[model samples]
Target: MSNPAARPWRETKEGIALDVRLTPRGGRDALDGVETLADGRAVLKARVRAAPTEGEANTALIRLLAQEFGLPRSQVTLASGATARLKTIALSGNAAAIATMLETRLGAGRQTG
Candidate 1:
């Protein structure tokens, strides 16, 4: 199988672009794992307890990602999909370091469809 983490994010001059699949109003806020879609695209799966109303889930997701990657909340921004389950988040930092951190935390074997 392809490395899910490798496919979900890409390095850019400013930072890294992350593809995320979010589940709002989940029991708790947490990183579930990686998920491969039917189209073979991979995304990082995360859940937030916050409801999907008035950007609450979006804010929670940003906070969670910032905390996970040790970046300031200001450094993490929603790049796309503001009101959708799939979102693209841009993190302003070293792409390589961010990728390494995510790989270490999520692991290669942890993937769900």
Candidate 2:
């Protein structure tokens, strides 16, 4: 069985590659299950309260990620997933160090590449 706290998602391409399990209209926007990428990327899983409509979810996602990483909202960008549960987010600056922090804090495994 998979560890409940173990994140299967990862970070790549100087960005975060996630296997998102979206729950639209959730109680609140949040980020969790941060991990490391071997290519020096920061990976994390997120949850948002906005519905998946008119880019609402996307906006919420960026806001949540920015808040989680303590970066500006513009620092987080949706690389894909205009209308999908799973999405890729690109993060900028000190990515490797951030990934290390996520891995240590969230207890998620790291990506080799």
With candidate 1 superimposed using the best TM-score fit, by how many Å does residue 97's alpha carbon deviate from the native?
1.6
Clashes of each: 0, 0
Best by lDDT: 1
Q: All candidates' TM-scores? A: 0.89, 0.66
Candidate 1: lDDT of 60? 96
In candidate 1, stretches whose alpha carbon ends up further than 4 angstroms from where it belongs are 1-6
Q: What's the lDDT of the predicted structure labeled candidate 2?
A: 0.62
- Index of the highest-TM-score prediction: 1
State the TM-score for model 2: 0.66
- lDDT of the structure predicted as candidate 1: 0.86
- Each prediction's RMSD to truth: 2.0, 7.1
Q: After superposition, how far is residue 24 of candidate 2 from its true place, in Å?
A: 1.6
